[model samples]
Target chain A: MFSELNSILNTSPENCPQGEFTLVSDRKADASFLIHHFLSFYLRAGCKVCFLGLVQSFSHYSAVSQRLGVSLTQAREKGQLVFLEGLKGALGVLLEEEPSPGTHMLGFLRSPRSDLRELFEFVRASSTVLLSLGVRVGAVVDFAHYCRAFVCSKLQGNMVMLIRGEDEEEEECDEEGAEWLLRALTHQCSLALRVQGLPTGYCRDIHGQMEVFWRGHGSSVTGPQTQQKLFQYKVHDKGVSFFARGTSSAVL
Target chain B: MLLDIMQTNEVGGLVIIQDTVDCCGRQLLKGFIHCALKRDEVVHVLGFEVCENEFRGGLDSKFTQGLYFHDGYTDPLGWTECPPLTVHHFTPQDINTCLSQSEQLKTVTLVVDSLSWILRHHSPAIVCQRLQELRRGGALRSVLLLLHSDMHQQGIVGSLCHLATAVILVAPGMSGQHTVAKTTRRTKSGRVTREEECFSVSEDLTITIEAQSSCSGKTLPEPEEYEADPAANLTFNLRLSEVEREAKEKLSLPFVFSQEKKSALLHPRPGAGRILYEPDDNDDFDQEDPDDDLDV
Candidate 1:
């Protein structure tokens, strides 16, 4: 499904480099497809994957991964996948008289200051356990900074994060932190993928556009020679197709 | 012009490079690094955003000789046992200590890969105050700060810009080949210079300044240009020609009454006063009194 994207990236799941941080951002478009692609790709690579399902539930991801030829339930039973459902955990922390041990990772939710140190420690402990199992680890999380240092430096693993781009019209106080976090992560990430909808509004043929920025200074197969590239993509039930911007079917 | 400013012995106290997500200012920051190294100044980089390797990437090996990096990226919160620099309690004093590590600190260029990170972790007022301390202490030659303008609110960006001696706004140029930098520099003599230039950074960390599109000192529109008639673009004529002016002066408007007519109209003969009334078909005039029906 991601053959075209792999070709453009010049690296597949098998040969993908470790200790690399990839940031996926979207503006006026949903980039959850890219997240699903990376999640399944890394899992198929036989790496221990820690899925921090913040924006969606485990069933949603499991359903999507099933369509992509991967069994998340089976991966979990085999100890290759660790799924942390943030929504469920948050509710458990809020309503449950006694939160379960597994939900302790979300203890930061009950804190007055909402400090993420507890959550960071939780991720660290999990990653350590995964590392002890003698497998490369790949973490899919929204909070990159909490696990970035440990995941990339200590474990020598890869981290892929998805953050929604800020809308210029909305200036909410909560969004300020998100915006700063996005910029800070972009500076640190080796690769950045941005998905944006058509500025001209909805189109029938072309869903949206994506830009890949190879900002990594690493000496890998795909070096920073190709700084950036743009492509138009259409998402399908089972797969997504990416083509050069002007080469979309409608444009032709 | 940007290169010229960097090459000079005395750059401003605080130089802020404002860039958006589309047009990154990292290349420009590296350009400043190269210029600082070329001038034989001690360069200390506080990298909170990227690792040392990534920061040093694409830079010439020779340029790295005099460059010192304070590791704020790795173990920023000191989650690990030991980190070279911990951002948990970052302050100007900590930076001063970092600067004092190197000998020959006569002329030092402190490059904050980004001040936005510091601003996020710290209050804007405190950050500005620390920057002022760093500037006023005379410990460093100059401070080069990289800021993501879109990431911060306009008020915060404005305050930071107010603190900086020079601000360079980098935007994507019309052509993708280069980026345009609009620089506004305030000199010590109270003279402000603004210029827009196109610049492209090569792979080897070399910056080539292209054509200068405009500069306040050189390309400013003259006073006469501002004084030019604004009616030039109007479809109708606003000014009359010499012959037309003479004809307009000779012509008399019908609405203007002479002194004699004015006095005559104001005084008016007593007997000449009369009322003229005309009733339309729709108008019903009751000339007869309704009281005639009553016994009055």
Candidate 2:
């Protein structure tokens, strides 16, 4: 499904196992390119895609997909694409003031259920419906940090959960919290990748660095020893390009 | 200065000024507001970190008339020192409400000087969604200038950068003479473009791009050739030149070598021709008696 990204991860589509969950931990760089490219890979591979955008708007999401050469309208018309606007309702639940009466009929959040299992199940059920349509299903979830790892463990298909780390100061104080979350999510995923934006002064074009921690569960590739693969990346017109630092040749 | 890299006229866009904790983000923000005001754009500032007086202390008196300052930092009971032209004080919880109200009335720009504070109080997801709403919403024909510190809430910063139309990262350089400014913009064609330059903040609070800070034309240091004509390594010496060496010898203390001190060792050395007799000592003489009767 993913031509260049596969090699960057050291795994091809033919060897890619099903039901693998990959977590992309982004610090400073824009993760939209990675998420969009991941979705585009599946869409190009004829997989039915469902994007559960909790933090991003459908217009911005679809615009990015369209720019990546994925026809969002055509894919939707063919029952191959679906967008789940989860943020609006989620925000309503998270609001401090209670939703007043008569707002329930207007489809506002009226329930006081504090558990995120409902949200997780809602997204999972949507992906299952797509899976039952006799095609591969790929789901990209934004703001999955709000969902519990155990709840995310129940998801199906090729799932990718994008989590943003804390700021530099908070990260220093409550690093255990961030690391605990990373450990929890990494335990649930097959492949764990971290993309960090390098401090902006050192290089000209390269904006950030990405490292693959490991691939578990259903992959033929063994994890690296002593060191994992590292590549510097820059955002471009097509998408993002990954290159080995100090070398002009592209890694993917 | 800051707006030179951006489109100042386009309505419904978000501009983020990402400055380090030590850099002058507020000054750059002041510059942006003045630029917007010069274009006859009505500017509303939601201040959470700095008070109105402190915020306007660096700004010109004429530019302050066109600006509407919303103070989120000061409590309602706080005393003011300056005669307010257009300053409003609201409780912290009512910041979003105040923002929405001002956004509806403002004509040009909505500047939030403390997005980090807002993100702390609200969900990052909701904050980003609201910022996007303010960017595209028709209630306001305004652009957003979000001033954020580079030290805190980096995850939220990434999300904000993704949502923003333009992101200006300002960091103080090593020498402190200029600041490194990295601007990443999302073009109308949906392409992400990045530009890096150095800028110096002047005494007048204006930012000027340094002309000699292009990092593209820099060349790598040449590697040393090790195989061609290798030379022998030289030894390090502490001695001075010949004259100094002669002077040192003249001033040196006399070496009084003791002539063959034979008693220096624990046992005097036996002469080669001398014969020594061996003493016969019983092993029991050196050993203490097992039963000395001391226990009794």
Candidate 3:
């Protein structure tokens, strides 16, 4: 006996909601179902899990995880196990970039292999919705800020990019210059997202800024479209981004 | 950048990394501890998936202690309900910059969460250069006992190994009936060294299967392109010497040109691009042959 499904589904608020809720399936492929299930549960739990895997098809797991969010442990204990596909609904974030329209492209470390630590602030803020929003009183984000933060927080998902304005190279790089250009995107994670390169699509240098493009496709209805400016960064911590979370899910 | 040394001068200390320590400082400590330890040691850690709520809960004398930690990216909630650990939460830049930047410890025992993306994002050359520079600055006293995981897609780790005082590679050893293989080859001598020692990290992030023994000259890291830089100024320094030689050669040219011709020319005649350093008497300057006549 669920209270409502599409009621709040369509009007989903911008804030990350923490509650105990069940996820329903909408006839997606096997992978989509599993992904949706777990994603819904985590979203309600107020935990941001950066679901990473192959960049395509992650539904079966999503759906199953969503359906059994609460009783999954019990289900397994009673010999009632629901096995789902692993590879569906798997595209974590899309990549698209073209060129930036400014005369600025600075290398992070050096030309050929530039260092990228300079852009960590922007990336960190963009990764978590709560990180981008106003201060939290308890766990509640300001509703208004929540909307903008939700949109801005996902620069990698929905933002389109146009790197390299005119065919000019050689740009000056100062901390201030790159910071100004590497601001947050407005809307995040949508279908028809555009990016040109790896990670962030654009880089600003002494010459100018270049734009890359990518498209983000949420659960098919295609979330709002956006284009994150060429906000790029390269962190120097070689082992920082990855940590073995201990044989996650035991190979599922 | 000056804090990576250990009191002992050996290679690598047992580095215990968790969200409670500074990534940068602990990294240096890794090198420092390795360099300082006279005997093999064990490093411990607890955080994230293992002890999220109790990340820094067990630093008491009762529980095992890790050298230090830098909270890179901890679980959003932190180790459950615990007030943020007393440890500092430095930005990625701080940790990254100092890994090689700090020379406090060499021969460090480094234990990190993962090594894949970190290797790709930050080239190991930069890390080594930072370490080398620190070493030159007398920041570290000994070799480093590095403790790290081989993130599946690590880049230039082989090259990084070259600058290491000694390398200790740990990974999944083997499955039932199958032998797990992770080998390091020395670049100078193309010898293939098999590793009899093995290491395993338990689910609790504790160190296991450590068979630390002193073995010399097992392997050399490949002298790949990533191995080229350490002095950071090698290119500039070499280029300057080359330019100086060329300038001297140009000034000592055998040309009998007018004073104005020599005065006006900034470099060798348009086509000459070589930096010939030797002062050969047979430079053909004095040859009577028409083909050998010096021309500006």
Candidate 4:
């Protein structure tokens, strides 16, 4: 699903970039669709996947994964998948109780604190652990409402951050802090993709458009050639597929 | 209108009041508190931007007993000055404790005087996470009144607005005529409706909120005319298109047909001045030519 996106970033499944983060945002796209497609893309390529779901629970993810035929259970048994229920984990930490059974932890699991330093330590440790297991870890964090700073700054694995889109009417809204956050994340991440839902006429399926902004390195070594590509996409019975910008013709 | 909404909204509803730091604008928040207290609801004031004395000074002495102030700035370690009422420091770290405490109250209204204050010490992500947890846990039983000042963390306010069940935006309107408050409510059925009110702030800091009929969708004759020709009515004349605007120089010109100023033109007018034909004074003709020695 994200082959074009990976190719645009000049990254491959076998030789994946480490400690890099990508931000996927939209004002109205279903986050589950975007996140599941992203995870499925990486997992299909034989990469170890760790989904730290802050918005949706494990069961919800399992259902979506099952529908997509991703087989997260079999992958988990083979040590290729780790699903950390971040919402419950965060609630547990807030209540100072141990996360319930079958709960996996990441990013500062030892100390229960919101301090930036402590949070970065968690990212560093988690990535190191996953790397030591002889797998290239790609993590997907469903940042429905909130996410920490280190996830943008310190993670040592390929990261996909999912942020909920705001109302289009509130496009010029007073959330300067959130804008600043998007600005900061945009600068940190190699790719910033915006997925927006487009109204489908007569058809009941969910259709959307994806815009990928790939900024070439500004340094002297690599000549500046920033590229922005737009693709129309749709979520289907199998998974997601991208088509030409204004047409329904799928991009093979 | 806010009071009516407060009465009708469910117990777990979250309402946000976004106001400027101006004194008159801040008084409107007190009006909300007064409304909440009048309903016999226990109100918790999480004062992060303001102090206990600041909020207490505005209200009567009798109503102070029913109000509890969690002075976020004064108390560093979640300690309370008065006994019986436990007030905690409004730190990002202690957000869970605050939410849990509010969960225990059956008919309590939790009000954060200014959420932007927390954003100063912490990132928006952490604040948003805590708020999501608070909303999910149903801790906003009675009401969650989040008052955000436009002083800082302006962007995060959008996310907060997204999470709020109702939003009351207060702004200064038209040279003391009124303070406008636009309240947008998202019903339980997910329908959104917006209502606007024009309120006047009295000398004693009492805010009288009245409906702004002009802002409502129903057409009134005066507003209809105003909308038809806003510039003519002087309703909105701050901006005009280039074609409609009178030339800057033409405004200063009299009827006497003054010459168009050529000095302002970037390109110089050729043949406007005499060309000098002077010889080179530094050239020594006597030294260069031997025949000139006779004349010398």
What do the candidate models score in CA lDDT, each in turn?
0.74, 0.55, 0.29, 0.55
Which parts of model 2 have CA positions greater than 4 angstroms off? A10-16, A91-113, A128-156, A169-176, A200-203, A219-227, A249-252, B1-296
DockQ of candidate 4 is 0.01
Docking class of 2: incorrect
- Recovered native contacts, candidate 4: 0.00
* CAPRI verdict (incorrect, acceptable, medium, high) for model 3: incorrect
lDDT of 1 at A198: 84
Residue by residue across B194-287, what tens digits does model 4's lDDT show? 7787776443334566556455543234555566643566756687678667575357555444346544344457856656756487645665
Q: Write the per-residue lDDT of candidate 3 for residues A121-171, one digit (tens) a residue.
A: 222333222111111111111121222222333332111111111122214
Q: In candidate 4, list every pair of residues with a backbone clash.
A: A108-A122, A175-B155, A176-B154, A176-B155, A177-B155, A177-B156, A178-B155, A178-B156, B11-B141
Off by over 4 Å in 3: A1-30, A39-252, B1-66, B74-124, B141-155, B175-194, B198-296
Of the candidates shown, which would achieve the greatest DockQ relative to the real structure? 1
Candidate 2: tens digits of C-alpha lDDT, residues A65-181: 788788777887898877655554345545644755322321323343222334444544434221111011111111132122212223335766666654452434231355435
Tell me which residue pairs clash in candidate 2: A167-B154
Tens digit of lDDT per residue, candidate 4, span A1-252?
Answer: 455555655766677665345667665666456677667666776766666566767778677778877777887798877766666766776576765763334334444342323322334333311111111111111121112222222333466776554445343423333443444345434566777777553234437777887542111111112246777777667656666666675332
Query: Which is better, 1 or 2, measured by DockQ?
Result: 1
TM-score for each of the candidates:
0.79, 0.37, 0.30, 0.38
RMSD (Cα, Å) of model 1: 8.7
Candidate 1 fraction of reference contacts recovered = 0.13
Worst 10 residues of 3 chain A by lDDT: A20-29
